[model samples]
Target: MVEKDGIVRVGLDAGMNALVRPAMYDAWHDIVNLQRIDAPADGQFDVVGPICESSDLFGKRRRLPRDTAPGDVMLLADTGAYGHAMASRYNLRELPPEDVIDGPVA
Candidate 1:
């Protein structure tokens, strides 16, 4: 995991021969526990999404803070690099909206 300025970068794979992080040794990521902000974690877990697919997982047995749950915003750290760059509009699903965190405004 490499750091440029202050932001962390995370890589995610969609199975199908795709690999995230360790495979490429690109960026560093942190598994944030969006559920419980003040509690301790019992164990690690594989954070998944509701996309209904085998490769729709975010992290695998990652150690988080605690109390993560549905409707909570769990951030996949350091995903700004190849995350949006490799987005596809498959299954008629709309691409996620993008927000500009920095840089000059147009």
Candidate 2:
């Protein structure tokens, strides 16, 4: 994560290899800070991945918490249907791991 001029940029652990919807379709995914889900959005962000390509962006002008920082876990909402299914080996990046959350537990 990096911040400049009140714009936070978040680099994903997995790049286009894990999700291609955004880069390929200009898709918009809701990014939520798991630790501060209810906090007000203090700034906009360019959520991207670690790939070298310019199309590796996940979102632009995404609003998130002001204190969001590196190592913070975030959720790209509504991605279960297309995120992993569209993954590729581009840039030699590995696919993201899955974590199953059972029931209504948070």
Please name the candidate that would achieve the greatest TM-score relative to the true structure.
2
TM-score of each: 0.56, 0.84
Per-residue accuracy of model 2 over 1-106 as CA lDDT, tens digit each = 7777876788878677787888888877888888887889986789888986888888998889877788889888777858867777776666778775566745
lDDT of 1 by residue, 1-106 (tens): 2223642222322321222342344334565655565667664665544454655555655675434454554555556657666666656556666554575757
TM-score of 2: 0.84
In candidate 1, where is summed lDDT lowest over 10 consecutive residues? 8-17
Best lDDT goes to which candidate?
2
Off by over 4 Å in 2: 3-7, 102-106
Give the Å error, residue 89, model 1: 1.0
Q: lDDT at 65 for candidate 2?
A: 88
- Report lDDT (CA) for all predictions: 0.49, 0.81
